[model samples]
Target: MPVRRRRSTALAAAVATATTLGATALAALGGATTASAAEAPLADYELTWGIKQSYRTYVGMFGSFTASEGAGQAPGSGAFTFTDGTGTYDTTAHTVDLAFRGRLVSASAAHHFEVTLTDLRFDSGAGEITADVTTVDTSGATPTKKGDDVPLAKVAVTRTMTDMATTLTTEAGEYLGSDGYAGAAGDPLTVVKKTPPTTEPTTGPTPGPTGEPTTGEPSKEPTTDPEPTDPQTTPATREPSPTASTSAAPSAPATTAPATTAPTKGEIADGTLGWGVKESFRAYVVGTVAKGRVTVSGGATQSAGNGAFTFKDATGTYDTDADKLTATFKGAVNFKGHESGGSYGLDLTLSNLKATLDGGTGTLSADVNSLGTQTKGVVLADLEAKSGDLKAAQDVVTVDDVAATLTAAGAKAFGDFYRAGTALDTVDLSVALSDDARLPDGGGSDTSGGTSGGSGTAGGSTGGGTGTAGGTGSTVGGTGTTTGGSLGGGSLASTGSDIPGPALGAAAGAAVVVGAGAVYAARRRRTQGRSAE
Candidate 1:
């Protein structure tokens, strides 16, 4: 009984030790996981930024006319200044304030212009931020001949502030990096204002009385010139004139005309240059040459007729050629492979072309082809063709090699023939031809040689021996002799040639045995008896 109790106690102690060790190990693992999480770097952070910029413009016009000649309308100088207040920029929304003022620099003309902003929000990020000044306040003096001020048709300026956090890193525990923060030069705060059209009051002429004429001459003269009244009123009191009483009749209430509101500022729509058209103006998302279809709303206009206007996928099209184009998008423009959200320019071309999202700027050239003496030009220069069976993002169809093929005289050509004109100029004119000409196979052998040899049997055997003879005799010997060779004048011997002695004897013995076997046997027996005696 005592030994059993001791064994039980030892087992219990072992279990307790194991339990304690496991708890310690589990606690250590938990601590390690927590440390790793705390030490891990932050992926990214969101920030609100603001920017304020000032710009000055100088325009010069030259012609054959001078101030005295008065040939040009406004051949003088003009100056303008623009100021944009700070705006908020976060992942969600972007807002800013824009203002402008312009004055005629030359004395020949007097000019004045002003544009104010109430609230500008860029949610879709499709088009750029711009200002347009239509009516100039020429309330002051007008310009003479050469010094006339030229009214500005419109002024457009685009600005973009990017989220630097994508390229920046922050401490493990820090909320955001230092470079993540952005502010304007003066740290100016945004001011929101209500901008409504100004109302004008209408004026009316005064009347003499309800029924009296308000014309050039008075309707009635003073009934009597005060009957030659003395300098002082006879009664020390004068009655109020009828005309004065009539003028007091609530001078007709001024009527104000309803104010006409101008169109909203910086309103733009989101658009796309559908599918493969993004890289090249070659085809639509359906693999057909883009028919140059462009649809725009929110007061937008096409800039150029050629390649400038195109569709990418089904979203919308941008007419970069249009000046001062604006559109209001119903939804945000989504791009493939990019997480950041904003309107991006589809300014892609064939070579060195880049698609810029986040409201970036880039330039593209036009592609031109020559036919005889005429040149056909493609407005969209940077066009690319995709090979293989990879579909484009945004539900854009893949363009096959056949659909993108261009002939030598087509508007655009690719591959070796694209530059054939230059090659033709430097080509050699002299060369010789052969009747049985053949190209060397890649293995460095004349393939034509094998074809020239007609079908025939191989003479040599696989074991390096000659083939069988025609008859049932032995095969022709290695020494070029037949099996049934001659002893002296046999069938196989050459005329006048000596036969070999050993070969000749063997043949003669074989022939004699066949002709006289019995006779030879009798003779041999007799010879044996004689020898025995």
Candidate 2:
């Protein structure tokens, strides 16, 4: 690897329109589209980028960003994700050109700014990254707009294409004039291969749909259906079933299957779960970088003073004989900031947080919406509770401080902010297997116990002011309280140069991909920071 100063998220996806991207590709390859493209295996490469974290946070403070057409935000880091990466990396020539597909829009009506990242060209041989852009600004008199193909920032960096850190060119600075920023140091970009498991868009449907449609039988439907069609309504079509066959073939197993569930699993009537995700990241979103607010509802509570979030009304099953447990908690926590045009630059929702355990090995899952898309039952963290920690007593099972780490799947679901195996806040859970069973009365299982910042006398770096998430020792399964408080406030601990701070604001310069005619509006200008010039 070549030596580097620092690394930032790169443009894994381009928000450029189809026409513009095609032109860029053709121009880069000397107009031999059909000749060169087929040789590259465009589908193999993957790229992840956040443009500029500080700028993204600034935009999010007013409006929101959305990715569509097979593009998304990294679960671990909230960066833009683009796949089907196609390019030529020629070793002999010492040249590399990588182009990606997809589109992204960061709009903020409040700031009177909206820009779509259209096209980007990373020419390793030339050490240059250029962008084509389109912007909409109502902030000025009579709404000024730049063309979709406006040649935007062109920066220089190292020749390697791994995780890229970008900077701005003089041209970018001139465009910004006094309103925006033109400087060194942008966001980070990561380039890697798109694995087969993550290749849902390409290969997934082929085997699952084509092969299964021929073997065609079970995976698509419940074999328990009495017949292929409803016998009562269809009657004469195949007419023999419901009345005559009720006592025979399909009926017995259908009824029996329902009865078997009760024996194999123990029902949960009462329970609670306490978890806080990654403390630092949570702190970031609530902190200066994000300036977002966190809300808990659906019967959840926060312990006093930035305590662990407690999800209540647990309902699921525990298989004591097999040492397996599936507990689902009610309630939801939403983090939103960067309000613009009724959209948030940052929006994440975690609801119906679930936990599963067997032989002390377990996982936590949730219905997550981070990239303007909702994915249900996404396994987020792997639970590491020793079997001894999960002992059942008096018809109740309590697990405390069960360690949690991000999984690959969790990393993908959360935004690629952190890699797999990164530690999250410890988990504490309790489930009552019987009517007389009871959960702990308060936030006794909290691990962080951090009220202010958390180090000495509590840290200001989110190691404080949790002051609100799980309610202070509220009763589990009681009428849930909807508590609202921001995760980040006050000043940031680190404000060194080189890192983008909200102090010098900018908007929509993140990817700066080109989109000639596309436009959306950002919401309220949360604070006077930057505008996409």
- Give the Cα lDDT of each candidate: 0.20, 0.49
All candidates: CA RMSD in angstroms? Answer: 48.2, 20.4
**Clash number for model 1?**
21
TM-score for each model? 0.13, 0.39
The segments of candidate 2 whose C-alpha lies over 4 angstroms from its true place after superposition are 1-43, 139-143, 147-160, 170-181, 195-448, 451-533
What is the C-alpha lDDT profile of model 2 across 1-533, one tens digit per residue? 11111211122112121233565764564443332332222224555666655445344434557787657875322578776665543322233455566677766554455566645445454455544545555455324444432333333433334566665554433332211235434556555544344433343323322221122233422222111222122224323544567658676556544432224356887898988775445544444323445566777765543345888888998877777889999888776543546666666778999998888888999987763667788888999885544466655788887889888767665445456776677888888876665567746332322222211111111211222232221110001111231112112222111111121223322211111001111211221122111
- Candidate 1, 1-533: lDDT as tens digits: 00111122223222333344565653564533422322211111111212111101000100011121101122111111222222211111111222222211211111122212112222112212222212222233222122111111111212222321111111100111011111111111212221111310111122212111112112221121111122122112323544666776555222211222212222212222211222111111101011112222222112221112222111222222231121111211111110113311111112111221112121122222111111223222222233222221221222221112222322122211122121110000000011121212112121111111111111111111112221110111111122344433222221111111121234333532232222223333343333222
